[model samples]
Target: MHKTKKNKKYTGKIYRYTMLVFVISFLILNSFVHWQMQLQKQTKEAKATYTAETMVQRIETYLNQYQTKSVLLKQIVESDENMNMVKFETLADFIIKGNRALRGIELAKDGIVSEVYPVESNAQAIGLDILTYPARKDYAALAKKSGEYVMAGPLELIQGGTGMLLINPVYTVGAASEKSFWGFTILVLDWDTVIEELNLDGLDDSFYHYRIWNMDIRTGKQNLLIEYGDDGLKDELLVSCDMRNDTWYVEIEPVNGWFSTTEFLVNSMICILLSLFFAVLFLQYAIHRQEEFAHHEEMMRAAKEIQEANEVKSRFLFNMSHDLRTPINAVIGFTELLERHSDDEKKVTDYVKKIQLSSNILLSIINHVLEMSRIENGKESLNEDTESVKELIRTIDAVFETTSRQKNITCEYHVDVIHEYAVFDMTKVEEIFLNIMSNAVKYTPEGGHITADVTEVCEKDHKALYRITIQDTGIGMSEEFIPHLFEPFARERTSTESKVLGTGLGMPIVKALVELMGGTVNVESKVGCGTKISVELFFEIADGKRAEESDQKQEISSTEGIENLAGRRILLAEDNPLNAEITVTLLEESGLSVDHAEDGKMCIEMLHQKEAGYYAAILMDIQMPQMDGYQAARAIRKADDAYASIPIIAMTANAFEEDRKLALESGMNDYIAKPIRMEIVLDVLKQWI
Candidate 1:
């Protein structure tokens, strides 16, 4: 009797569990169906929003293309040098050539398209009436009226769907609007291109239908310009344009965006329910917590492994750099010495050039590494201040004057000094001027003129500021490279082929600095012509308007610290023998008094005991073992007796320019470098003396 009762109890327990599972499965499945329907509805609304925005962006992109192409075409029509009948004939030839070259630029003349770019399948459009055409005629008329820019709303084609056009009126030189309207330049674009690029195919397996509509909410023109799919599911949108410039871009564009996807939700519900069902079966309530703990531990172990590897990588790079710089410096320095002492003049010149090239490479690697460190450390902060226009320009001129003269390129400077001072970071200003000027000189073929001008643009609000325009008659850049000019590690099409290519960090650095200083950079160029870079800095009227000086005769002579070092025998307090050797070489070349002291203690001993006129200055190294330059300078400055009068200049391998200022601020007279330049030593001496 007891055995039978126990069997019945076991059967009842099994029955209860099976019934419970059945009931739960039924409830979950029904709930999933309801949730999927809601998800589809939400997807539909999201898709609608995305579609609205993406459509706007597509229209804007096409409009921009139209505007640019129209400008190019107008220039062809209106140039005085190209207005003759033969030139016009040549222009027609150019039109054909350009059309064949580019995918999206077309040219129309006298209401007839002589050339349509790409020479696509449609040849019937050639010699057709562009004026009477359904797409371009209206925009051409507006261009005639405005003489500026005219954009058309999206229009539906009589044959099928939607299109858009932009027009600009091209005028001849001094050509009256009535006489020189030169038939309007029309830019035609099809919006379907955007749809083709952004459509989602293999990513989603659900019902999603996407369509794009321009945000012509203002123009009252809601012509459906693009549609992505024919599925009944809600559409998705990726990007939209009617927002803030940076945030204005729409992503998860329409048609694939928040669109009703009943199928997607149903599938998702199936996944969630399946997950819960398995979770309940395999995982007991107590074991579920234990499984979570185990998963966390596994993740932590993986994370720890990655962290250890990263630490090792970091150490490796650090050690590699430390090891590499020593050999590199030795190679470069000895190579320079060999080139200098070489008997053959040509070989000497070759070696000298090679040394320069090698030094540039070393400098590039250093800058890249240093830049990475600075970014990681958050140290590249903008320290802005008001700077003098004349001083700034003169400093820039001093830097590039020799190079410019070498190329026989006369640089004419026009400074609107009346608006004298600008509130910007001086360091950044120097960088911007130097980079642009260097490129201008490098790119402008020999003998080309470079002009840098600053003018006060009259503002409507009675607030006037400075406009610094640096225009070079150098080999200008291609239109394609313009967008990427400011990207780091990006060399232009010309830059790559030219012998003057740099580390490619200059322009990006310039842009970052300018933005930090609250300024903007503008560029315009034509291939084979020249490039003009106009940088507009926000200036506060601090020093009053200085005059516009087209030419300034101020010259930066090869400095020897000549005056500062005059009769001042500098006490060379350096511990490193290699650094001491280089210092002695540069000092002798600059014609200065340099007395060697092995370390800071020796420096103090020599200064304490030396005769009154034995030393006039001390070029201290900041990181000496016995005592650093800062401490030595402070001790010398604090000296009560005769030694206090002698000046100390810190010579350091630290290339941060601010370090020099820091040395001076710490009671030192000036600072120079370890691998010192003869000119710099001379300049420092002249200034201090």
Candidate 2:
């Protein structure tokens, strides 16, 4: 009996200990559940806050870009005292086409809305006076008073659209101490489109629903500009941005609301389960932590990549600056020297030669940049014509022979051709050869050998295949550098290369042009040895009839034929006085009678003043005051006057193929891109007149 009693007491003690253990474990589980719930709540709120901040920053950046564009447009308009509507329209079209968020642009002159681009969509808004509109007048008045750009809108438009407007008041500096007010340049911004442009579509529904409201209005009233989601949710995080004179508020709420019955039940269930499955919960938490760590590592790597890319871009820009400035500085400095040493013919000639070389270098850099743009836009096209293979080879040799000889480099050129004539684009051929030979001359050391070997590979279907190999015995390049040699701005940082000046665009342009011409370019180089570049190009052989005709033709031996244009009268219409004077002097020097007009309007008037055939040809500037060259040409073509069929040559600085096409489409007989060479002008005159 005593032994049984002792055993019972021990069993009671064991039961009590087990109960105590259960109580302690249950309390620990409850504590964990509470902590988890608190942590989840904090994390959700934190996430919502961070998302809102990021969205705001993105929106701000997008808005600032538009704002900056608006400011630039304002400057463009205010730059000229007599701001032409056509120019403004063109500028506005370019801007609107490039940016989807911008609906259109409106220009007001003397408080009257005069012009609106994309007239089909915003035609009804044209001629609407901003000073007379009740809703827009206050903002216009404010912009005028401040004489600055002012953000206005989210207001109802009279044209039946709701959007925002950025109004910038323009003022002209007068001869007196006072400034004259010149109406406003307004940018119409589509609000919904802006939200789309900001890419804030799904963010509203994913993390939190938000409402943007403006509280500071002219009428001392609060108004909701835009809203998304749960109206009854009172617990929300509020963020505000100062929009000019208004306080723009964004109120966001968690999708599930702060106090949710589902959340409470989930926490309770989790607390109960934690008592039994604490190990599993710990494992899941550990996995989540590991995922977070990996995400952090990925983010760090991405940041590093971004930094490296930025560094590369910065270096590229720096190199571009150095390259561009070198030629520009040389040109300017040599021109000054020429002006000072005008009396010394030899010194003047040397300075002029240096200036010409510098100018050529500058033009090459510009061409490379423009060519890249054309390639990117898929606008690069080939202009094929019948070319004499011998002449082409001779021209290439002529181009590099002098430079190569000056540098003491033994440059040799060899051409093997089955036919003397082939159909190819001469301009593209010259560009490719010039770039390659220029590089060969620049990179090859003094006394080094450079050989250009050309051979006909094959001929079938009237298409001829040719291979061109340019080998230079100079400090070549490392294997790794060779791979990136054709990349723009790529250069190997070697001691020998440091003294060489280049845009680093030659190989890239050459490769691009070769590929465009349906050819392949390959390079083989080893450091301390040499570099050899090979290109294979295909061309169509000129037909027998054309080849026979070309063979029968002989070169003009004298300028007596071209002298027929010397006594002819020419009409030159240019806006800039300096350019016009220079053109007039050139025409006079060529023994041609020149008539000057300030603009296209004057040109038309001047032509009307003369009889048919009085003026041999009319040189028209495309961008002029009253009427552009295109419109003027069209007007002249439609006229019933004698000069209706008179040859019109477009003279403009626009050097694109599209510009040439447009000029021809506008009834111009010929197109001359400016920085006009006198010889080219004379040639055009000889052809058309």
Candidate 3:
């Protein structure tokens, strides 16, 4: 009887332990399955959003290209009011030949279509009064009223099929320079051809269904254009693309819905199996618990470290964002002031100067950010060139002379070097010194003294070790802050509190560049007293003959006369209309006649069509739609024609040492970084032309 009682007790214990293990395992497995389902749904939704956005961008770009062409046609018509049908046909043929999506081009005279390209099949569109058409008249009127381009339809076309119409209103200039409406320049885009060109149908796959539609503005109802899958779409993921006068929506959803029933069933079965397996192996789990505990502790430490790093980055970003906005806000505010006080000459002048100052500050912040990014990504490299130590010091002095004088600060520089010229990365060395000096000047109170001392420490193996020390009687940092002084976005005081403007990336950049050049940097500061920074760098002594040759070349280059630039004609190849307009204005203001090309391809064609000596130079932008500046430069050089030797200067926003080198390598005569100052442009132009 006692033996029977013990057996019963043992069986009850086993049953209880098994049930506990099964319950725990089932709960965990079910939670994991739920988590997996949520993750899958999130991933699908993200992908759908991405796909929708991509389609929108592609369609917008396609539409914008036709809009640009339409504007170009309008410009041609307005320039020559007597443009005959033969001339119109020739221009239309050129515009429509390469693009398969274009159905045809039409010229409407006073809202009546009088001309159509490819007159055979599209003749039916000729003489059709577009303004009288019920479906098209509203958009036509809108185009005329707004004095801008307007888009209409996926409506039935007289030439057959469905298409969209881009209407650009043309205006004629009378003898008194009065403008009158001259009807429209219309571009017909075939809907099916657009879909085929953009591969819209291919976006749908086994995993997802998509629908594209436009809203009818008149009726406030969705006009479904294309769908790939089921009859009813839930509009789970929707993205709107804005065209000229309409917004098109792309909606996407998972084919199997957000949660898959089949997947859920499979996961549930696996969870059940896993629960049973865990119950069977419950006794063995205790054996490995100690090992798992140790692993968990290690994982926790790693996660803590990762979190700390993330927090640091977050803090840095927060500080940078605040610092970046100060100058930007100043620029924006001053611009508004300038606009409001346009008639006041003195206020306008003052506001313009303030705007320029703010712009410079904004540029400095951007430069610091870019420099830090390059350093962090390990993309920065030394471009070693022979540089004069005296010249470097002179340049720095010249830069700060005005600011120091304005603030009543006495800034002095002392240099004692055995070698005057050394082979070093001039840009990097200049940046390091400039960054330190700028901070010293910024923080130093008015009437305070600042000094920069440069001396040769030692020489070995034909390399000279130079030491630079900058000292300032300024608001020094706290002892505790010194440790984090070289960290990115580290600042001693907030700009608002200190009344100082800076990105806080300067010192970090200085430290990074110093380290990159196999150098050391040290700082000494006391809160009430002052701050002094010392940097030691080694540079190879440049060959005397080479240094002399470089100096002579620089002298000769600087002496080149820019007077010849007056009345000179040059080609400005740029894609953006605003940039092109700004550049043309600047060039024209400098007494130079400018001919603008929309892209590299157009620039090349214009060159080919012009006389050999017509254009004195070509200012080519590096990034353009068809054939970039590099390819254009190379082509021009390889043509071996009379114009092949024409000077091509790269005027682009790609402002980096490597970019300049690449431009030169691609047969460009010179490179001009944009935000183009007229003086720099003229200097560069004078050298080549």
TM-score for each predicted model, relative to the true structure: 0.34, 0.44, 0.40
Q: Which stretches of candidate 3 lie over 4 Å from their true place?
A: 1-368, 495-501, 558-570, 574-605, 611-618, 622-650, 656-672, 675-689
Name the top TM-score candidate: 2
Q: Arrange candidates by lDDT, descending.
A: 3, 2, 1
Report the number of backbone clashes for model 2. 0
Better of 1 and 2 by TM-score: 2
lDDT of 2 at 448: 95
Q: Give lDDT tens digits, candidate 2, residues 22-103.
A: 4566688778877867766786777777777667667667777777878888788777757677787788888788788788
Better of 2 and 3 by lDDT: 3
Global lDDT of each model?
A: 0.61, 0.76, 0.82
Best by lDDT: 3
Q: List the residue pairs that clash in candidate 2.
A: none
Off by over 4 Å in 2: 1-369, 494-498, 543-568, 575-593, 623-647, 657-670, 675-689
RMSD of each predicted structure: 25.7, 35.0, 28.6
lDDT of 1 at 387: 60
Q: Write one digit per residue (lDDT tens) for candidate 3, span 1-689.
A: 98667656766666688789999999998998899788777877888888877777777887899988998999999999899988998999999988999989999999999999888868999888878887788878889989999877777898899998899999998889899999999999999998788876565455668777888655677877767776567646787777667788988888778876656776798899999998878644543343344478885786689789989988676656633554455566666567657899998997777676556555655565566768778886777888888877875674565567656789999999999889887667777887788888888998899999999999999999999999999999899999999877778798897888766777887888898899999999999688999999999998889689668755554334335677899999999999999999988877889999998899999999987899999999999997999999999999978999999999999988789999999999999887877767878887787
